[model samples]
Target: MSVWLPTAPCTPRDCAGHLGARRAPLPAAVLLTAGCALTLLGVACVPAVLLLGPAHRDRLIRGWAYAVVRAFGVRVRVTGVTAGEGRSPVGELVVANHVSWLDIPLVATVLPARMLAKSEIRTWPLLGPLAALGGTLFIERDRLRALPGAVRALAGALASGSRVAVFPQGSTWCGRSGGGRFRHAAFQAAVDAGAVVRPVRIRYLTAELHPAGAAAFVGEDPLAASLWRVVTAAGLTAEIRVLPPIPAGSEPDRRALARAAQSAVASDSANRPAESVHH
Candidate 1:
């Protein structure tokens, strides 16, 4: 769970105002704890979901994901479809910008894909086991030597007609001043598997649908503190936009694919409409 924490300083005025807003204004512990408990319950159901077969597993997992977001007091609004509705593009590799931990359930609900995660996520409390069981492919990021194997594993999953998701930025950031550079590793997986590279953008908003500073998990903010910030918000909303898929033919190499996907996400995030949907 030790992701990169940018040492970027907070604006003095922004800090003073945000500090006043930091007071835990609601029963955050109760809500967040309940969310965690329910998510674990979903994890417990995974074995059974698998038994029901892959198609059933996806629907059940999606239902479970939707419930988790409710418990967190966040609403979700989605635009477009992952590879378009009803069209299951084989080897669908979904790539999205990194934001908060909340991004997982938010996006997973839309596309029932296995996540490609850092090995550190396996160390998280209750959520870790759930993620692992939910079909996350853990990469020992510290070991550069393991990249090829990890990429091949991802390719294998994609080749099997299972969708996979990754945060190509490789780290989270405060999206207000723009996002971090997208790394090319995940795109290589797309290339290796000949998968459809789907770019997604995740935005956190307040009840009024404005950007939520409290929701961004930037810097060295502890997980507990981040959870508290989310729980205390009167209400938060996460928007997931599934842009058009980029196939191998569109880009000559991994670098081209990665750069194209990154630009798509950045452009979409910037030009996205202000309208918000509640559900």
Candidate 2:
């Protein structure tokens, strides 16, 4: 198929990425064939610390996340200064671009923040329990009435000095020119909690050093399928850039804050490559 060359995650936004439906499956199959031992090891070691508590569980999860991407042969490079030198923040909302399902583990690998996710994810086979153990806050997306309560919970968490990471985009994207729009709903929590919204940009690179569009779980993709594609994809890298926090107070309201924060992140990543890859 004809497509754009992704050279690396630093590729220009206008660049086109091929939808590798044909190319991803075979490598995914082969990777899975070799992934059994690693998978079993993780399952055996990681879950053992689940009942300990949120802090212990989150740290273990972080270690597991590191093991996971490495096990799958994926490298990660993080840039930008995180608030408080990477320690969790009290009144800060971490807003990031959602590129793929890998964003979750990838982010968690760096900072132990409470993530806001859809309620339905709680029903997914094992992910539900794992996310719960990780202290994830689930929002009832189907019930609009529950939104305020969810926001309230997020605000409460932030006020209580817990770091919260949310994907204002609501869904994943291919990390190309038009990744996706940032919805304003999630921003309310920041306003309510008087927290500054920190914008984070996440991008995926193919093993061949190109932007890996197929790594995104945008459409009707199953969890297993996305995982297979990511692990099987060669030389894949997850680059996360934590932009400076946009002060919510600077904006009049949540909507303006959301727009400003989104633009800030978009402009930062679009303007140039990351300052430098993390060591």
Candidate 3:
């Protein structure tokens, strides 16, 4: 199997169950409407935002992302970001485990970087144009012949001091039952560009900090269904843990580097709750 198209065993029926106390229907509807409205507003403003200097543009993007998540009624808790880590000038390959559609905005809140998206997202209804306007790098994950070109594109972006956020897991998981392994393909770009690898860990939890499935968007889970689940799930919180970066040349090859990054992600914050700064 092509590492770029790795499969996960997680299914909506089995792993994406509602595990949290749900909000009343009216509140959920309001949250959903607000979230959708904010997302569309961001899309409409993308053109103007792009005209600003990079620093100003990124600040707006970060704020917009946080607002969108809040509109969905999901609290965000982020930890482990050191001083200047989020605003570093050095090019970095920001890799994370995929769990839900929310993962995109969640990551953007802390690291407003160029997203590495599956090419299919380019054709999505509203998100497609927004992603393009936001400078997302689309990769044809199913086409093995496209791997080299994708790698080159990623490397080119990183070599130019651009932070590129990627979900190296290839597919979303429940974030509880050992997620899929981090495929080595994307790590190749970091190695080629001599960029540092920043591994991030994301988890969805209920108010009591128990692992939550309501936010999972795994196999055959429709996007609308996932959104509804998230908005209605009472007191659900997304936890983002930014682990230490692995310097360039720390590993001799991409495989070793991927393994090292994966090890850090899997071991650093598994089930251990750090003091979080909520946004």
Candidate 4:
């Protein structure tokens, strides 16, 4: 199958259409095989590092997963992760806005973090296995009685020296429109655990280059096609900004803390001009 390469000297705006028109169907067999191979590689490494235990093992799995995604053609660019005052010795909670499924590997690549994911992901075919290996904590929103235990588990992970990554927005968006309203539960979790909340902003630079909502895996947009669109498109960039940490003592209430973090991320995202296009 012929792989379409966008022509040289093309503007970001024209690149997507040019590439999409010429896109040959990506081989399902190849994509599946590659994903399986990468996942197995991650699983294999787990037993060897038993001495380092769960925390370090989780980090290793996350690193392998990120490498797999990059090898499969997604390019991730991160900023502000290393900037801030740095995390405390007792671990921290990373609160960020969710944008895409890509955010999983994207955040993993930057931080040795564990995420609070929805329960549905635990049953996804290949992704489910990979996420399980990566130590993702799945939450069943409808199970009210189990929520306290879940929150306690999150606190335990932080106490044990693992950075927990949570999408406070609770849902994804195109970033042009606002993301979903921030959920205060994760912030409360942070406060209850006495962990610092590190806010992050994630933005995908694909709107000007690809179809609106092209990266989303909905309707006609299958996962493989979305992956192809992101990989082959010129000027495709996913920017993540990790802002300063907000100590638990700084905010009087969890809701206020959540709002402050959301505002910080939104403000930072708004200031950045959408002009970084790779030719």
Alpha-carbon error at 216 in model 4, in Å?
Answer: 2.4
Q: Which of the two, 1 or 4, has more TM-score?
A: 1
Task: Give the number of the best model, judged by TM-score.
Answer: 3
Of the candidates numbered 1 and 3, which has the greater TM-score value? 3
Model 3 TM-score, all chains together: 0.95
Per-candidate clashes come to 0, 3, 0, 0
Ranking by TM-score: 3, 1, 2, 4
Clashes of 2: 3
Tell me the whole-model lDDT of each prediction, alpha carbons only: 0.76, 0.69, 0.87, 0.63
lDDT by residue (1-279, candidate 4, tens digit) is: 111111122222332232232223464345445655775676566457545865565566556756766554445556664422334676688887765667776676656577788787788766676667667888876666776777888877877767889876655554545566677777777778788888887766643544234333332235555556554544445666767788876999888888888888878865754443221
RMSD of each: 3.5, 6.9, 1.6, 8.8
Model 3 Cα lDDT, one tens digit per residue, 1-279: 776788888898888877668899999999999999999998999989989987788788888998999999999888887324455556799999899988989998888888999998998766788899899999988899999999999999999999899999899999986588888878899888889999898899999888889999999888888889888899899988888789768999999999998888888764555476876
Sort the candidates on lDDT, descending order: 3, 1, 2, 4
Prediction 2 global C-alpha lDDT = 0.69
Weakest ten-residue segment in model 3 by summed lDDT = 82-91
**How would you encode candidate 1's per-residue C-alpha lDDT over 24-94 as one tens digit per residue?**
65577778888989888987887777788766667777778878887887778887654227436578888
Cα distance off (Å), candidate 3, residue 117: 1.2
| Candidate 1 residue-wise lDDT at 279 | 71
Q: In candidate 4, which residue ranges exceed 4 Å CA deviation?
A: 1-22, 26-36, 53-63, 83-87, 207-212, 218-235, 272-279
